[model samples]
Target chain A: MKKLSKRIIVGVLTLMLLCSSLFIPTAKASVPYDSYTYNFWLDPVESPNPYVPKDEFTGDPTTMGKFNNPQDLFITKDGIIYVADTDNNRIVFLDTSFQYIGEITTFHNGDTFNKPQGIFVTEGNHIFVADTENQRIVEFDENKQFVREILRPETELITDNTSFRPTKVVIDGAGRIYTLAIGINSGIVELNPDGTFQGFTGASEVNINPISYVWRRYFATDEQKKRMELIIPTEYNNLFLDNEEFIYVTMGNVDVKDYGIDVIRRLNPSGINVIRDFGYGSPIGDYFVRDQQDITRFNDITVTDYQVYTALDGVNGKLFTYDYDGNLLYVFGSNGARQGNFKNAVSVEQYQGTLYVLDNGNNSITSFELTEYGSLVNNAIKLHYEGKYEESAENWQQVLKFNANSDMAYIGLGKVYLRNGEYKKAMDYFKLANNRKYYSKAFTFYRRQFLGDNFGLIMTSVVIIIICILGLRVYLKTKKINVQKREVNGI
Target chain B: MSTYISTLRYSLYVIFHPFDGFWDLKREKRGSLSAALTITGILILTYVIRRQYTAFLFNTNDIKELNLILEIISVLLPFLLWCISNWCLTTLADGEGTFKDIVIATSYSLTPLVIINLPLIPLSYLFNLEEASMYYFFLTLSIIWTVGLMIFSTMITHQYTMKKTLLTIVGILIGMAVMIFIGLLFTSIIQQIIGFFYIIYKEIVFRF
Candidate 1:
């Protein structure tokens, strides 16, 4: 009986050890890359990743074959995803569950696509395909019927030397079409609803520093000048039309000096850049880069209805999300062959809160779901933007539980405290955020409150000091007169 | 102790009446090296206090990265360099002041920085961002007053014409730059020599 009891105890211990080991692996399953955000000093601060890879769809061969070098991904209001399968010359449709619905390969009397690079789905279920090599944009109805094709616009503004290969396209609320074509440095090509060419908008201004201008104008020989690269505006790589009808565009090959300035732009109706850069750092993807070549080149941008846009860095294979104030919310993903990482991320789209990134190098789509930390951050930003500071403060507090180093959360809480007449607490939060502007505002109120509280004591002290000074002055004058009288009497 | 206090008190007169005060400082033995050094120590303390206790709205420094030793060295090194450069230039330019005289005059001239900026630190806490211009105006005034005092001190100590003193000041600035370059080159060469010997020792050990 004793031997059997000892054997049972040993068996139980072995079972417990095996179970613990099984759970250990699951607990240690961390993502392949480190997630980080920028502090006020532009230093990258590591934090818990707000996104984790949920599902990866490489397409089922039995259903619609596999995606071959897909270049763009677009999600409609109803969460229907359209992948521009560039090399396959088709647009594949999928449901939110990654199940293949159908594809459009041939349309308009058997006219097949020639490397369609971009796809956009309007609210009315109309599909637009940027037939890149064909140099045209083809629109189709909800029933997969071809509506019309917009060819290259015949305008004097577009010189004959410029080729019109549309790479990305976006449609605003009023049905105004904007197309970003290859080798077009002018700007985004604006199109009327009926396919007539409007004018270009949001052309990047070429800034020439004095030294470079002097060298180019007076110093260089004609031969050397001819060999130098021409100074032209950078072309827009991709664009997204937000809910407010503002067009958000991204440029990848900007000059190194202009990396944080014009790389991301939000153009209003009159083509003026109206993006606010009031964050700790500009909405550049990476701050502390190793070299100029390692600078982030934004390949695609996707904006949610809340004005929170995420730009995909093609070079680093990362996603950078920023709020409307250009504050960087989070940065995740990297260039790797791991499940969560991407080899070459080309396009990004958002539906609800999930982000779908299309990888051209791996020919697959990876979906990232919002973690608890991500949802708290989004909730805080959304509430703050909606002027609901009381509710936003709660969400910001929850966000701090996940990321104590989040400056945005601290700033959000600071604003709430400022609104609730808690200036001292607001100042502390802003100090933690390293936000001097809001700290100044909070300090102004705090100083006023401090003075008001001690007003009586301050006035009494001033009066007492003034009276003491007057008394001392009168005593000194009489003593000097007495000394002079004594000296005059020869005492 | 009484003499030290008198010498320190004499800096106020020197700042206000530089021509006679600086002349008396050297010829009348009114200023002492200990007082000058004490004034420098106070200036350093004022700088540290300003960095630490200034209002959050006006302080742009990262408090987490503040190093007390670095702060002291940043102030002391530039001061010593300025004295050395000024003495070297003035001695060659037929001037009258010695190295000790230059150090004493320069330290005395820097009184305005301490007098003006020390009060401004407390006053900074009272001003808001909208009224920051007044604070900055005083800060700039302190710097300008100190610089003007320095030029006057240099002129009186060396007994030179205005143009000659101006030329000497410019030369001193260039001399400071040159000294910094030479110091960097010396350290880099020493580093290379040490690295070379280290590599040789490592190679000898590996061969054996």
Candidate 2:
């Protein structure tokens, strides 16, 4: 028994060592990158309206993202603005002079586009949308003519059972661009202009129901698809850019309330070291949710010299403005349908001196002349770390008046809770912050605090205990054998 | 019947008994972890061998060969694992039988797979077997292999009722599915993240 036990111990330990040696390199693969943080919020002054047919108020089911009703806005070198005109299922391009340069329709091709969501233009003049309806993206040339899709629903196209459902497309200055596709996991696919799966992002393993998940979860705001896309942090919604320092993303596939935010994320060029996040949207969206959870579900992003604008087509309508510091300048519109109000303001963009919003239910695009709203609040971090709970709470109280979905308020409350010996309340607030969908290193720190390091320590201790029991058993058996041998020899 | 077939069949039938007294042993004992551990250990060893001695594993390609190899390995892998595990179960745990007995018993395990998919293979020969048929073949093979593997793994894991084993297998499959989905999910994010920042990074580093 003793000898047999020794062999089993040797075998198990050898196996563990072999496993560590074999899989360790993969675990240790170090792709070094320096990540950065960026502030993305709703710029309310520009995006206007809350529009639902008085009838939609009684009916329209819950939905979100680049879906029809146009939430995002963008302009071209020619200064023409493009609206995803999502629900209408078309791309409406307005020339620099803000003249309507006609439109291109991609609907009725069935899978050509189910719901046309986010739209983007390249320097060379190509258009791509996060077309939710068709389960694929349709491409258009500068001439508004059909171009072959750079990507499609890759069910069988992927030889090894991999699947891809691309949502939004973003082009960087270098023209080496990417598509945020929903697949076995919600991830971004890197394609050399020719559309080869160079490598993958977000997801690598083939999911059990990857293709179905992409279809249901990835479409902008259709709940049937949303429920289908129920898995968290898998869909990439919209993208914004300001040179290379920061890239803002609206990732709604994770079921966050909206952009306030498991829906949005800020990443640097190398895609390493997530810099900062805006809101937390949902608990399932924890890894996917960003810092600014309570208020926004941003889709389209456009940046100009003076300000960066984000379209929030959440449960209500909103447009948030921010400077480089991730501070909110002003919020536009509210939750009622009006001339400036949006039922679902789906798209926003700046063309020349004018701003235009494509409201999905309003079925109208509203234009605005650009204006600068002064920076109102420094970041929550600056306030919290500086120990100004009273001031922060007051500011938060003011924000909650207009938008109760303010992540900063939640953070501020948490700080106040901690200061007042309201440990439980503080924990509650901190839990909110920690649990909101999207996060950077800041939220991760809080996550560790909330989950605590004890679980891991305990698991390790249990394993050690199991090993000790085995060792003890072996020792006792060997001792018994030794005693028996000595007694027999004496007899 | 030929000696091989009769012997194989008899050994299989004998293995189904509650316990085995056929194999020689110093003292029989059960080791549940031992069965799973051996399989896991071998997989790790194979991984090391493939990675460290890439030349031995492949001459032209790397891991992309997983799908094609899966067709044959799917059957062989289960059989080998069952043999090894049952050997440990019966010998190490005083499980019910010898390696030969378990091996023969599992030969019938493939009976269901053959019954389920037998028609599909011949149809491939009748069809062009190029475009659509090949795809159908792969799909059918995957289905048969999956069901067969689930049944085989569960039985070796324990002598629970078939219904219980089926439910447990389903649960395991769901868990695996979730794990795969999560992995793909991260990769998808990585792609988006990379794309979002790729241009920016190039411009910053190279200052283009």
Best by TM-score: 1
What is the alpha-carbon RMSD of candidate 1 to the true structure?
5.0
Where model 2 places Cα greater than 4 Å from the true spot, the runs are A1-73, A86-89, A96-98, A106-115, A129-138, A145-147, A153-165, A182-184, A202-231, A253-263, A276-295, A305-313, A352-354, A370-491, B1-208
Model 1 lDDT tens row, B1-208: 9999999999999888988998999999899999999999999999999988898778988888889999998889889989999998888888899999999999999999899899999999888789999999999998998899888888989998888888888998999999999999999999999999999999999999
- For A1-491, candidate 1 gives per-residue lDDT tens digits of 99999999999999999989887745226677788998888888998888889899998989898899999999998889999999999999999889999999998889999999999888899899999999999999999999999999888888865568999998877788899888887888999998889999988887667888899999999999999888887778898888998999888886677656558899998889998888887887788873576888999999887888899998899899999899999998999888888998999998889999999998999999998899899888888888888899999999999889999999999998999899999999999998988888999899899999999999999999999999999999999999999999999
DockQ of 2: 0.02
Q: How displaced is residue B179 in candidate 1, in Å?
A: 0.9
lDDT of 2 by residue, A1-491 (tens): 99999999999999999988887544113211111121122211222111211111111123212324554456776777776665566666656444555666643353345556567788778876766555555666777666766545334444434434555667677655566654534355556665555554433222235556565556646646534433443455666765553566664433333322334455566554253333321211112234544434555566654334444544446555543434443444455544455566666665554556666666556665432211213333334445677776666555445444444556666666556655556556644444222222233344455457477887899999999999999999999999999999995
DockQ of each: 0.79, 0.02
Question: Looking at candidate 2, what is the lDDT of residue B30?
Answer: 21
**lDDT, model 1:** 0.90
* Top-lDDT structure, candidate number: 1
Give the distance in Å from residue B188's predicted Cα in candidate 1 to where it truly belongs.
Answer: 1.4
Kindly report which residue stretches of model 1 are placed more than 4 angstroms away from their true locations once superposed.
Answer: A1-28, A468-491, B204-208
Query: Please, what are the lDDT tens digits per residue for candidate 2 over residues B107-204?
Result: 43343343334344443323221244464565467467545654653455344456755665555455555655776899999999999799788889
TM-score of chain A of 2: 0.48
